[model samples]
Target: MQLLEAKLHKIDRHNYRSYSSMRGEYTFVDFDFFIDTVQADPYAPASRVRARRKWALTDLAWLKDQSQDYQRAARDFIARQFADLSQQENGIQIDRPGQVILDRTAVVFDEEGIELRFRINLPADDRKIIAKKAMNLMTFTMPKIIRRSTIARELPIEEMKRHCEAVEDQVALRKQLEENNLLAFVADGSVLPRLAGNVDLPMANAIPFECPAELAIELDAPHKGKIRGMGVPKGITMIVGGGFHGKSTLLNAIESSVYDHIPGDGREYIVTDESATKIRAEDGRCVHNVDLSPYISNLPMGKDTAAFSTQDASGSTSQASWLQESLEAGAKALLIDEDTSASNFMIRDERMQALISKKDEPITPLVDRIALLRDQLDISVLLVMGGSGDYLDVADTVIQMHNYQALDVTAKAKEVIATHPTRRTSEGSEILPLPRTRQLNRAALKTMLEDGKFRIQVKNKTTLRFGRELIDLQALEQIADSSQLYTVGWLWFQLAQGKGWEKQPSKAFENMLNDDWFRTMPHYGDLAKPRAIDVMAVLNRMRKADFK
Candidate 1:
């Protein structure tokens, strides 16, 4: 406290070097505070003090000792503390201090001992020093807030602990996917619907999901012990049922299961492979140097699809490009819904096949090659179909959603398929060709750079305003938080750094995984770790990306 107080009288607004000199660590009895970021102008809104509070492992062990869920809840609990501590606007009793801030990922447990980022405004006297305000804040006000918010024995941590435990249990369940030969699992009692269109909260009257005995598989999760759920095995699995029968709802749940949820969020135990990607037709999305020959070929004008590049792609072309790019970025499983899929890309009925005549048609529908996706490429596909029965012939397992219940009808569907054959010709049996690695021209990126600095601004959770380009991520459903978006934007800037990023984008992710930036997740605050595929999904959509 004295150290922070000593620098109070020495702040020089004009030089700003006086403020830089004051940036250092100050220790209290229970925790140490390291001033991480110092604002140049103390009066500026962006000009603020960023510090981290580190507590002993013993002090935080109660939060993390039990399960991953408890640790996550503990983080949420601590973050809420700052909010709860806010008495009023411009609170904290300090002169001109801003609201206490904590990033979302700050609560997630890493190897580091429990630490949380904090930001508060330091008062300045005429752009110089406000020694008395600084002294009162550091020595009296700030300590009281920290003591109450963090170390108060009366505070409720148990509820948060249990919540975190439950959340982490879901994560643990997802990690066991490959070992169980399953791509996804939805626990018998999970709720699958949100309250409304915009509200993410689970509906009060939503039906609870129940797994059929035939499809139910039991697993010993770390926290939940023995749990039984519907395990969608590795291969082509189709969810086919009547409209408003929870087919898309179930599929939506499974697609989002790629991210772990909070406790009591109703879909907590539903787990999918972390590498699972939700693919849909995105018309007008940019496609850069992607090989669309497998899904599409022989354009009307004799256009090339081997290295497809389109500034404004059609529905069929965009979905094809999205799939090829996902494969390039190493997607293991695809979650697709017919409602959002391009009709032409999904299937070509026998009547349409007769009308178009195979020779005249440039496109080979997904129904023709979906089986090959599994058989040859080892990629699992989970498709939700309401109008198409053609998928049944190619489906390895059929799940019919009835009144929000999953009924395994593989045998029944097979019988129906045998009785009434569509006789759809298989188009391509050859495996999807490997994605060609791109060599990014650094000059293109450098030309986009402003003032010799890389530019990336996240407009929202689903939009990245990168330089002059707007990378739309509305269809990238798995991005769970705004912090993840912020991290991805910075990550793109990081990828643009140094050399060799152009040669192999996938390899860049692999090498970056070993980097301290990837391991530690630096610069961007509290980030949910995103897959390389998610990053590539955004980049592949960038119009300014120069790929060779």
Candidate 2:
């Protein structure tokens, strides 16, 4: 601490650039502080720093003995606490987590102690350093915030326990999905609607979800005991309803349930298969070497779709590419909503088939191949459809949402199929081959970084600027946080370090994203663990990427 103060004193009234000399480690009375990076000016990005307190100092060392999930939740809870406390000061900031509890580096736990990674904007008067103000912030305010967040007594003990337990329980529930032959579970009383289109908070006075008795199943959580919820069965399940009837709302909840939500977030008990991917029509997106033969075999001028590559794709082609890419990335279940999907890609009616004969039309819709995916590839699909009754013929389960309530309509849908049978013949081949793994060119990634001076930037959750390429990721609804995107860019940076092509990029990423994923990267608090599927999805969106 004296060292920090002395340096600040020497730089008092000096140019802001002098602050760079203060970058180093300092030993405080109760903890150790590290200024990893220094800002060049007051308006530049905040300086990165870390405060680590030994386990013996914090009565919260018991967290070290907990399960990995429990420990991750505890760390997230601590980071949230620090963020809340630091909000009073404009210059101090931490990477705050959202409703989901992701494995993040904002707060890390090692064998020795708990470390809090955050940013600090050095105090300045115009372009000159303000030594006294910097001293107060670093030596007094920051230390207090660090101690309160790390110490057990300073925290809400019961609230922390509940937070950690809820995450642990959600993890347990998700593990039970495969054994129960389920794709997702929505516990009774979960609030499905958010406050608005842009807001992610639960809406006030919203109708709570209720599982129809026919689809109700019980799963045991270590902390919450048995939880009864709607178990969306494996295979093709359709959610059908009128406009504003909460059909898309239900699908949104299930898609977000792939990650564990914080307590009282309204969907805390809801859980879905971690490998579930939500894919939609992303028109104008780039497609690289994807096999779209099952859905689109023949094209104008005898174009080959077996190794499809397009700089700009149509809605139907983009959707097909996403589906095939998700399969290659090891997606076990797919979630789709008709509102965001391409009509032509989802289905082609008998009238259209008759008007344009199969010989002339080259596109094969998803309706023809959903059953093939379920039976041959062992993949499950949950779709929200209102326009197409054609899917009823192949659906294993049907649910209808009426005025925000769910009703089991599988029997009714079967009855409808019997009374009003469709004349549209299935358009695709009977057998669906598993999507082949595409090798990624590591040289391309490295070249991109080199061309752009090795820069990685994230814009909210919608865009990633890796090297010189700006990739659009607005269609990836399952990315829980922007921090995950930051991790994705760094993961690609590691992959770019190797020479030649990566034979199995998805599997390689899966192996890198294990329990010790963050250990290999720079110690930045903004990094959060991302799913392998999302990592590959981001890479697939990069226009400059080369895949074969």
Candidate 3:
């Protein structure tokens, strides 16, 4: 503390140049603090102080003591503390907790110690520096704030840590889903509904989720001991019920289960396959030479479906291309809701089949090939439907959501299908081609870069402005946080660099996943760990993406 105070006291108040001189290390109780960055101008919101704290090896051993899930929980717990401390500080530049993001680091059990990185507001009067005040902030105020919020015994740190552990435990259970043949799970007592149409927080007076005894399964987790939940098996599964009967609400929870949530967020225990993606119709979205022959072929003008490209695609064609793109990205399970899906792309009923001859129709619809996706491609489909009974014949499990309760009606649905069989003729190509590597138009994409750095800008939660391209992510329902978008932006920046990106997009993504800087950056802490496919979605949607 004396060392920091002395350095601050040595600086001249009016000489703002002294602010940069204050960048160094200071020793405090139980931790070593290093000032990694200092803001040149104190009055500017951009002006900031970045620091890192290293704790004792033994103190950290407990955090990384358990499995990967435990480590992720502990890290999340520490990040929560960082946010709380920043909010309580009341410091001039350091009060915003939003800037404190723990790195989205992989949970490893062999860690020797834990280090937390945070940014503080370096106080100043306009452009002039306040040396003594700065000393008080660094030496006295922030230390106490960090201790009380982070290391002190007063806060419910243990309970918060337990919350992260529970969420991670749920995430761990999802890893065994493929081997167990389960697509998704919702724990008993989980609150599924949101507060309202606009709000995302758990709804007041919402119904708690209870697994029907018929489909309830028990799994042993590391932290939560034994967990009993409703398990939705693989293959084509449907959630059907009347309006506002929790059909969309139930699918909403399942799709969002891809990322771990905060403790007490109500959906914390919900788990879905990591590769599960919500499929939707994206009208006017750009498509680049994707093979859509499986769903649509023999166009009216004789346009080729096998290497299809479109600048402004219709609802059905856009949905078909998006499905093929998702499959190319290695989707294991697809989450689809009828409300967001294209009517024609989902089903061609008997009436429609009879009305239009096979030669007259170019579209095959998803129903015919959905079974093939499960049986041949080993990909599962979870669809939310209220209007269609045509899907019952292909459904392995049908869950009826009535007033927020799930009823396993697979047998009843099958019986209905047997008694009233649909004479709808199936239409689809036999083979679904896998996605191949795409060659980048490096010159056009490089135009978006600035002075060797890709100018990545985030417009909002629903949009990402990458260079001149506006990638629409409104259809990507699983991307819940803004940070995930930022990570995607960075991934595009890497892709735009155009060096060593000529290989398969998946391979390039795997290499980026292993990069040291990519793995440990502060941006990673804010990330939800999107799959390579999600990253590819951004690239595929880029309007400026000139692929060879």
Query: Which candidate achieves the best lDDT against the true structure?
Result: 2
Superposed model 3: Cα runs more than 4 Å off: 1-48, 90-112, 123-135, 149-157, 437-447, 451-453, 495-501, 514-528
**lDDT at 373, model 1:** 87
Model 2, 383: alpha-carbon shift in Å? 0.5
The lDDT, on a scale of 0 to 1, for candidate 3 is: 0.72
C-alpha lDDT score of every prediction, in listed order: 0.72, 0.94, 0.72
Which candidate ranks first by TM-score, i.e. highest? 2
lDDT of 3 at 531: 63
lDDT of model number 1: 0.72
Report the lDDT tens digits of candidate 3 across residue range 1-548.
Answer: 67777777787466675777766777786556666567666553333333333445224445544655556566556556656665655562232112111225322123334555455667677667787777777777776655554443545756866766776677678876877789988889999998876577788888899988889998767778778899999999999988988999999888878767676778877888978888888999889888888888899788998888998988998888888888877788888999988899999998888999888988888888888898888889999999989888789999999889999998899889889988888787676555555665555566766643555656465787776566787877766656567777776666666753364675577567652534444422234345677777777888767765
- Per-candidate clashes come to 6, 0, 6
TM-score for all predictions? 0.85, 0.99, 0.87
Give per-model CA RMSD. Answer: 4.7, 0.8, 3.7
Clashing pairs in 1: 69-164, 69-165, 70-164, 70-165, 439-502, 440-502
- Misplaced by over 4 Å in model 1 are 1-48, 61-77, 80-113, 121-145, 152-155, 429-431, 451-453, 511-526
* Candidate 1 residue-pair clash tally: 6
Expressed as tens digits, the lDDT of each residue in 229-330 for candidate 2 is 899999999999999999999999999999999998999999999999999999999999999999997799998999999999999999999999999999
Return the candidate ranking by TM-score, descending.
Answer: 2, 3, 1
| Predicted candidate 1 versus true structure: per-residue lDDT over 353-443, tens digit per residue | 7788887887899998888889878999999998989999889999999988889999999899889988767776466656676677655
Tell me which residue pairs clash in candidate 2.
none
